[model samples]
Structure formats: structure tokens, C-alpha cells
Target chain A: MKRLVILAVLIVFCSSMAYGDAYRVSMRWSAKPGYLRLVLESGEEIIKTARVYHSYSLVKVEFQSEFSFDYENTPDAVDISHKGSSLFININGLKDVKVFRLADPSRLVIDAEIEKTANAKTVPEEPVKPYGLSDVVMVIDPGHGGYSMGLVGSDYKEKDIVLSIARSLRYTAGQAGAKVFLTRSTDKYVSIDERINSTYKKKPDVFISLHMSSSPDFVVYYAKMDTSIRSKDRYMLKYSQLGHLGDSVKLSRVMAEVLREKFKRKVRIISMPLPLLSSIGSAAITIELPDGKYFDYNASNRYALVNTILKGIGKYER
Target chain B: MKDNRYLTALISILFILVLAGGYIYLIRMHPPEIAMENKTEPSSQPVTKPGSEEHISIKLFFPEGHKLVMEEREIPRVFSQKKILREVIREFLKGPAGTGPFIMPEGVILLSVYIGSDGVAYIDLSEDLRRNFHGDAIDEYLLLKGIYESTISNIKINDVKILIDDKEVDTIGGHFYANRPLKQLVTQEIKFD
Candidate 1:
């Protein structure tokens, strides 16, 4: 009778172990506000949460088994596909993936892996409701334009590079089904105050300022500036959703990690007080892409950057 | 047994009283009245004769380095100001060579400067300025050199030590370092940007 009972217990334990083969994904925490990131064992399929500022808004979801999938953000849903053993994602119609590695508050890395016998089609696309009590809206600010070329490199101008990246971001964001607005689409000058005022009118869920570095060196740089303009009224309106201005630090880290992996370049993220990065009422981050001066901004680099960013948006889409 | 307990209690009380008496005696012997009075009073003024100590003012210049330091001294300022210090810094943003429209980008740079007691000037920023600055090395060199050079020249000091911000920086976006300090070449050459 004792032997039979032991055998029965062993069989139950074995079956439970066999049934539960899920990979554990872990994330490092920082004081900044943004989506929580989790890295899978495969280093290819990263899971991200919707935009969140308050700690109470964080949510964790576990998968039964690991699978390979590349994601692109669209208005209705995220387009996800798997490339055999690897994950290759396409955004809107753009191809290629770029990853950015950033370190400031801390390093947050997103990696994915493929599960055997699981096809890309098996993974379902789920719709996300807007963040907060109201609808989700995002403001995209392109850095430098018109007469202000910002940083001038030998081959490209900072204004042009940021504008292109911003346009791509806007397209992907719109496809993700969020209301997106751009401070300027053409090569025209918009005063710093005007940009701030426009963002205030929309009362966005997040603000992303796009810029490029002018360092003759090919290093990835990230900056967040502290602004003196303390709008008590604005703070009261968005404080619960946006947390504080310091959330930019978290947003920069997440975006930098994605950008670095996509471009395969030495990425460095910095924190500073600047008008554009500091003016947003919600979570804001400024991304400065390599200006192809010290480094070659070849086709691979562009595709990698675009694909990675789109995937990140899809993962973080609300 | 009751008689023994009473005797023990009496002895303990006597010991306590003796200790208290000793403590009070020590306290009375070292009273702080005199010391406290002295501390509360102020001292009288000092009288000095004319020409007992000589005061001198000196200026140091770095025309190319674009920095200046002014020192005023009684007699003992010589040894404190004459030590050798090394610094690695990027070139300033504006200078004679950088007067044109272009800019340079490159690596870490070294600069060594010296200071003297009398503050006379002799400075050197030549090829060393361009040594580590890349691409537009000339432009970077000119900017750094112009700032330091102009500052030293305007000051009347004969000797100066020009060190960049304490330690070595990788590359301020792609400039270079010379790694050595030069003597003051001229005083009038320093120009302010």
C-alpha cells in the first residue's frame, strides 16, 4: 500500500512538471514611468506592457510556452510574424529591426526566443484599451527644422534625419489606433513655446521628442532636461497619469535598448534639461539617431532601426 | 543571620557616601570659573610698522590655451604656486585657427602648463594643440588655444600653469590632447573671445 501511494505521488509530480514548461520573464525596476519590460530566454521575443506612470498600473502576464513572433504596430492590431527559429517583425510595411541599448536609470533589455511546434499564426492579436480613465493620445515632436538645422554632419542634417524617423513613428502609432499629432511635418520653424502649447491642448498620454546627435563620433546619446516652467494647473490635470517629469528617464532607457540592438552601434544615453524634452505634460523621451557621419547609416541600419521601433510600439501599445 | 544582614547594609551605605565625597572634592578642585571668564573676553588690537611685509600682485597667461589666473602675495606665495600640474582638455570653441567656418571632431587631448612666483609669461601651444584633435583638428586646436592664449596675455603675470579640467576626457566629440604643459610665450598675445 505504501509503495503504491509513493508511485501515485511521483506520477502526479511528473505530469505537473511536464505540463508547466513556461519560461520565466523578469524585469528590473526604476523610478521612471513607462512600460514594464521582460526579457525571455531566447533573446528575441520581448514582452512589454502598455504605457504606465503609476506603479499601481503595472500588470504582468505569463505565457504557457515561449514562441517566436515579430510585431508591427497598426491602427487596428499589431502585425506579428515569426521567422523560422528567429523573430522578424515588420511595421506598417517597413522591413528590418533596430535595437537601442541605453543606460541611465538602469539597463532594461528585451529579448525573445522561439518555442518548438508553435507557428506565428498561433499567437493571437489582442486589442488594448486606452490608458487612464480617458482615451489615449500621443504627441510626436520632431527636433530642429527650417533654418535651424541643429547639428550638421558631413553627409546628413539633424533636422532631416529626425523628421524621417518621426514620420515613421507617426505612421506606426496611427496604425496602433492612437490619436497622434506632429508639431511640424515640413521644414518650418516652430517656437519652443508653441510646441509646448500644442501639447497642452491635446493633453496627450505621452510625448516623444525626436532629435539627432551632432558629435562627430558615432555614439548613441539620450538626454532628459529639467524645465523651470511649473504649470500647477497642468500638473493637477495630468499628475495622476504622467507621474512626474522624471519619467523621461524610464522612457529613454526602454527606447535606447531597442535602438541599440537594431543598429548594432555603441549606444549612450544621457540626461539633461532641455526645452523640448522637459515641456511635455506626460511621459516624454528624446531619441537622437546616429547622423551617419562617423558611422555609416546604410540600408541595414535604417531597416533595423525602423523594425525595432515599430515592434516596441506594438508591444507597448494600449 | 539578621545581625549579619544589617552589618552588610551599613557597609554598603558607607562606601557610597565615600565615593560621593571624593567626586565632589575632585569637582571643587577643578572649577572652570577662570577659564570661562577668559573665553568670554576679547583680545586687544595688534600694532604694525610700515614696510614690514611687502604685497605683490602677479598674472599668468596662456594665449593658445585661453585661460588666465591672477595671484596676489605677501612673501610666502612662491612654493605653494610653483608645483607641476598636468591636465587633458579639449580645445575651446573659438580661436585664431577656428576663426573660419568649419569645425573639427576627434579624441582625448593632453595639456601641461606651469605657474611662477613673479607671474611673468612664456607659453607654448603649437603642434601639440593639433596633435589629438581630428578631422578639423586645426579648428579645435585654434579654439582651445585662442581662449587660453588670450587670457594669459591680458594678465600681467609672468608665469602660469595651464591644466585642462583635472583629468583626461576621452574625446569631447572628437578632439585631441598634447599631454604636456608649455611655457608662456608672450603676455600681449592673449585675446578674450
Candidate 2:
């Protein structure tokens, strides 16, 4: 009897060791325009089985296993459940709970907002305002710098070529009445995280990443949609992170078409999951210039490229 | 004395016959086993020269704008899959005779090709590919698409895993995600109205 009990205990221990440990969840909060964004960080992947819902003015995000919260009590997160494997946070005034995931140290983020029509007894009046390009903001980024010289061609370097173009673009875009911001003004090393953070700070209407290719041809690309996600999850993620994927695709298409029509250059538009463009909170695209040898740094050429992009953005208004 | 000499010669003949019989018995016993062992060893197929009458033609792909254009070339007909792949890549990297963009970087060299049972082709390229690439989205896309199209056209490959200097890179040109096995890009061709 004693031997059998010991064998059973050993089998249990081995099986548990083989499966490894479950995921632990940590939480943080940030302020958005009209709501609070609760971010949950997990060391392991947040699987498809994780559940999140709202009930009785409280947002409950439940996982299969228990976790610990290492965050201070914020004003947005009114209360939190400490029992069991569930997180019941009191979002009393907030409505419409949304959840999604981010890569590179996986995080399951949740966003909730206070609906404007929640307590309204009658239809609200719509306000119409004057429209101009003043509100439109464009953020341009030149790829690679510092130790990373990018691709060095026979005569010109990629970093120099792109920076010159981006500088030209900023000046030209100003003529079109759009506020322009460059991620790096000089030949400095800027990490992707810093670029993203800076772009987010500006809350720009569009983000364009400028780069040069080895081939003497131009190509445009939009952020590719992740097909692995379920339709529902994709919708939430697209809305939360990108805001409008349709706008991004349209922007890239228009930019490509405009470039092809004006410059007589062979241009192709593709969808790829480029981090700089994909993770930003605006319609974004990356424009790859022709090979270094073919790069034209003349004022007229840069002006033309900038004009083409501005024209493309004009179509977005219509 | 003559009978004694004849008896000695008979004994010598008997001794030689016994040795020969023993050798034959051992060979007969081990023949099947030795043959089976040789059969179980990996197969080595000889490469057929292009000049040979039985040589076959294989198509190689190159970048034409955004599309991959096919150009056929005759190579030594090698029966080994790995050998066939190596020859195909060697010819493909030599650039196509067609008047279009050069498919790869100027000094890029192919290190090796690994084909797995899961139909994934892992291509090892020299560091020149990553180092000399014109850090642009279109340039990287064209290079990768051309190589992928050429490889898939020449061989049966479901996915392509690209490795530069024996290490996987997050992005080839700081744009396209390349950490995972790349599938065929749909927008590789320009459609005319």
C-alpha cells in the first residue's frame, strides 16, 4: 500500500513538471481621450481561451489561472478582485470594454470608454465645423542611422539619401498646409520604440516611413492584417491600435498610384506587417525610393514626391 | 619410396581444398547480410552532365519589375534532391539573361540549401545579402520574392526560411517581417486593365 502511494505521488509530480507553469497576469493603466486603457502584461502568451467581459458596471477579465498585480491603485481602476483566477475591476462610469494583444513581450491590453449616448433622453445635435489641412499632421521617419549606416551603395549611403529626402519632404509638406514632424532631424540613432513613442505623442493623422531600395524602383506598403486572429479579436485590435485599417490601405494605394502617375516610375503597393507603420495610431505607409544610384536628391524631385503624397492625402478627404 | 611421395602430394592437395571450401562457406553465409547493409546506406546519385543526351531543362525565375519572369536553362541532371536544389540556385543567382533588375545583391553568395520533409526550404545566404542590401522595402521585397518564386518554380517548396550568415533576422530591409517562414506574396505581379 505504501509503495503504491509513493508511485502515484511521483507520477503526479513528473506530469506537473512536464507541463510547466501557468501564466501570471500583471496590470497597468493609461489615459486615452475619453477613457482609460488597462494593459495586462503576461510573461507567457495569452491564449485563445482567455475571457473578458463587463457586468454590473464592473469589467471582469478572467484567465484560466491566477495571477498577481504589481500596480498601484489608480483612479481609473476603482476596484479589483483579489480572489480566485479572475480580475473584477470597477469601471463604474466606463462602457464598451475592449481587449487585444501586442507582441514583443506579449501584453493583453484592455480599453474602456464612457459612451456619450448612455444617459441621453433625446437625439444629440450634430456640430459641423470648418475644414482645412491645418488639422492634418504628417510624421516622416528616415530609416537607419549612427552605427547602422543602412545600405552603402557605390557612391551614396541609404541614411544620407533618406534623411535628405525626408528633410525635403518636411519643407514641401508645409507648403501643402500640413504640419510635418521628422522622427530624426540629424544623423542620429533612433530605436523603433523611441520612434513609436514620439509618433504617438504627436497624435499625427498619417505616418510615412521613408527608405531606399537597391533596385531603381519605388514601392509602397501598408500594414498587413494578421489573419491568424479571430474575426472578433481582429476587429477589436484593429480599432484599438490602428483605428482604421481601411484608411491605411486606401492611403497606400493612393500614394502608390499618385507616384506612378506623376513620376512615370514603376511602383508597386504591398501589405506587410512593418512594426513602425502597423503599431501607430494613424493611417500609415512606407515609401521605398529607388536604389541609391537612382536616388534623386534634387529640390525639384523631392518637391514632386512630397506633392504626390500631399495629393494622395487630399483624396482621403473626399 | 614413390608411394610415400604420392601420399604426401595427395595430403597437400587435400589441405588446399579444405582452405578453399572454408572460404566459400563463409562468403556464402555473409553475402546477403553484407548486401543488405550496403542497401540500407544512403543513396548517392551521380550528376548528369548538361552535355549528356539525357540532360533535362529546369526553369529559373528572375525579377521583372514586380513580377517574377521565368527563364529556362539546362543543367547537369542530378538525382539527389539537395544536389538539384544547389544547381538550381547556382544558376538562378547567376542572374537572368532577360533585361530586368538584378535579382540579388551584387556580391551575395549562397552558402547552402536545406530541404525538410515538411516541404520547407531553408536557404543560407552570405552576409553580403544583408549587408549590401539597399535598405528599402521594395528592394528587399523584390529580392525575396524573386528568390522565392524561382525556388518554388524549380522545386516543390511550401515555405521558404531565409537565413543570412547562418542567423535569422527580424526584418530583411527594416520593413518586411522575415523571422518566420515566408509564404508567397500575392502582389508580386502588376495587373493591367
Candidate 3:
């Protein structure tokens, strides 16, 4: 009897072990003034790969294991598709997907902003007065803060140099009647998510990220997907979803031309799939400055670089 | 009294035997348990010989203008695919012989390279690649593209996945997402519409 009891207990324990690591998926959405926020809750770390079918306002979450979702009392009516170990959570009027991972309940939360519909019955809005470049809103992000020193030169830190340049650009751009915002105004560590969230929230007209390069020459980049040689048809370009990739490329070209003409430095414009540039709603470009012996920001040439960027912005709008 | 003495001696012998058995069990399990713990660390080595060296002609990619260009390079090649990838990357990091306007960030070190059966090559680099970025989006793009293109063109591998210090990185220089493996031959020539 004792042996039989032990065997029964062993069988139960072994069976329980089979389902030990099983996980489930839950979703919730809340309506805000301008957009809708959707949160997805899961037991394990949720996979980050997702595809948005804009026509259907659908988002497909790709995962490796079996999972289930909680559909009770959802704010928006969504179509749920569970096929071959993937979930397609489709909601009406989904515009953007911003994901956040919470540690408390181990939830993978997605904030999907809804697209606003045009109200034909409302009164026609009045035409506003014209302002030259005044309507242009710009966000100048100086990369790296606190512990993320970026690149450390022999004498100067990349964070300090870029921040100084950003400060100067902000003042210059503001004086030109444009509203400017900075990701970090001081020396503090901010995650990439916070920076992207802030930029997307602001929805600026143009976004320029500043960085100091350890390389000898300056570089400008927009957003493009890197191709894989081995991957089949799975690799796709992400810039199409960026929404501002066109503006980004155009702005990048103008900036490159102006910087090359003014500074006579080697400047190359390339496309990359950058989170800050591609994920944000605004037209974004990242400019890298040379931190070599000849490229000093404190010298008189600092203002020249700023003037060059300002000219590039003017050229972009024109 | 004699019966009590015999019982005591038998009990002591049995206790000693139990103690010896427990000690032997622990001794047998200790080494393997420690080995299991060590196995949890990052797989630092690849399934290839590191010291085998030969000569081969490989196609190298470099950043030229706004595009990546290919050049043929004849160098002392290593036998293993990982070593070959490492040597080629090191050569690219050393910069081309002529006035090529593109180079990776200074101080970036290649940690390890592991090619899987799925044709994806995991290239582990030091954190300096991320920490030492000086904010040039174009340079970052070119450097990453150079790595991707050079590896794929020279090696039989299909994709390049970058890891910083044996850990996955989200993005390098805030411009590109490094979380996924980059396919080879992906070009970013500026197209105006």
C-alpha cells in the first residue's frame, strides 16, 4: 500500500511538471481623449515581434508557446485569431503600437493610438494666419546621458559635447520662431523607450537626434531595414510603417548637402532602422558630428554647424 | 549487560555505514552539479577549430558614399567558418587600405562568433560598440552594414545577429534595432520620390 501510494504521487507530480511552464495572454484597452491604450498581459516574457495590418486595424503577436487570452469586458471590439501558435488581436481604428513590459505581473502592454475620424456635421474650422517656419516644431535629442557616455574622447565626453550642441541648437532654433523640445535637458539616464514615447507624444514636425562620433567624419542617417542573406521572404522593410521616412530622407539629404557645403567635412547620408527615428510619428533624422582633433564644438565653427542645420531645416520646409 | 553491549556495537556500526553511504552519494553528485552550474554561462566557444590558418580570397564590403561597395581581399584565412568571419571582421575593423570614408567606432572588439545550423551567425561584440557610439547615424549604419555585408558575402552564412557582450541589444546608436538578425545584401541607397 505504501509503495502504491508513492507511485501514485510520482505520477501526479510528473503530470503536473508537464504543464508547469504553460502561459496565458490577456488583453485590455482603455479610451483616452485622443487615442486608445491596449495592454496585453502574459505570464512569461512576451515576444516582441508584431505585424500591423492597417487595413484591418489588426495586430498579430507572434509567440512560440500555447497561450490563451482574456476577452471579457474589452473596451473595443476586436477580432481574435489563434492559429499555429500565434495570436492576431484585431481592433477597430488602431493607428500605432507602442509596447511596454511591466515586471509586476509580467505583462506585455501595448498602447495603440486610434485614428481620429473626420466629423462632416461639425462647422468648418477657420483658416489660421501664416507663420514662416513658426508652425514647424522640432525636437533636438542629444544622445547618451549619465552612465551612457556615448563615446569618450581623450578630453571630452560624447554626452557633454552633444548636449552642449543641442542646447545651442535649441536656442538658435527657438530664436528663429520654432518651438523646440529636448529629450534630456540635463545629465540624467533615460531609457530608449522614454525617449521614443516622449517624441511620439509630442508629434513634432521634425525630429533631429544629435550624437558625437568616434569616427573622423560626420554621418547622417534616416530609417531603413537591414537585409539578411539567409532569411527567406521574412525580411521586410520597416521604413514604410515609419510614416515619416520620406520626410526623414529628404531632411537628411538637405542636412547632408548643407553640412558638406558649409563645413567642407566628409558627410555621408545612410538609411537605418533606428527606433527613435522609425518608431516616432514625426519626421526624424540623426546627425553624427566628428569628435576628432579638428572638430571642436567650443570653437567658432560650432555656430557654423548650428547655422548649417538651421539652414537645412529651412531648406526642408521650402 | 553483555546483550546491551552487543546491541550498542551493532547500532554504532550501522550508523557508521549510513554516514559513509551519505558521504559517498554527496561526493558522487558534487562534481556533476558544479559542472551543470558552469554550463549555464554563455556559450563562449563555437564548434570550430581556432588555430587552423590558410590563405583564401574573400569578398569584402566597405561603406562608400551612401552605399556599400564590395572589394576582393586576399588574406591568410582560417579553416573554421567562425574564425574566417572573425578574421574578415577584424580586417574590416582595421579599415581598408585606401581612403575609404567608412570605419566602425574605435575600440569596438569582437567577442565571439557562433554559426548555427539555421544559417544564422551570432556575432558577439564587446559593449564598446554600443557605449562608444558618438551619435552618427550614417556611420553607425555603414558600420553595421559593412559587418553584415562582409560576413555574408565571404561566408556561407545567411544572416548576422549582433550581441553585445554575449547579451542581446535592442539597438545600436538609437537608429537601428539590433534585436533581430540583419539579412545580408540589404542596401539603403537614397531614393527620392
List, residue by residue over B1-193, the lDDT tens digit for candidate 1. Answer: 9999999999999999999999998878754432332232122111122454332222222223223222212222121221111111122322123243333233334333433333432233333323323222223334444444433433333333333344332222122222322232222232211
Correct interface contacts retained, every candidate: 0.00, 0.28, 0.33
Per-residue CA lDDT of model 1 for A254-318, tens digit only, reads 66666666656656665433334445666665555655476554434444454565554434442
Candidate 3: lDDT of B80? 54
lDDT of 3 by residue, A1-318 (tens): 999999999999987665544456677767653366667766554534333233324566776566655667544224466776577665433446776666766666667665332001111122321224576898889887655666655555666566656766676677668888899765555667678778766778888988875566677877664343235533323222245667888889888899989888888776655656656665788888887455755434666666778788888988
Which pairs clash (backbone N, Cα, C closer than 3 Å) in model 2?
none
Count the clashes in each prediction. 74, 0, 14
The sequence of per-residue lDDT tens digits that candidate 2 reaches over residues A1-318 is 999999999999987764444455667787643467778777554544567887534677777766555677554224466567777775423547778877666677877774321111111122211223555798999887543456665445666556666765676566557788999765556776678778888888888888875566787877765555555765452323455668878888888888889889888777765667766778887787777577654445655665666667767655
Error of 3 at B8 (Å): 38
Model 1: residues with Cα > 4 Å off, grouped in runs: A1-136, A216-243, A295-300, A313-318, B1-93, B96-193
lDDT of each: 0.41, 0.65, 0.66
TM-score of 2: 0.52
CAPRI grade of model 1: incorrect
Worst 10 residues of 3 chain B by lDDT: B40-49
Tell me candidate 3's interface RMSD.
4.6
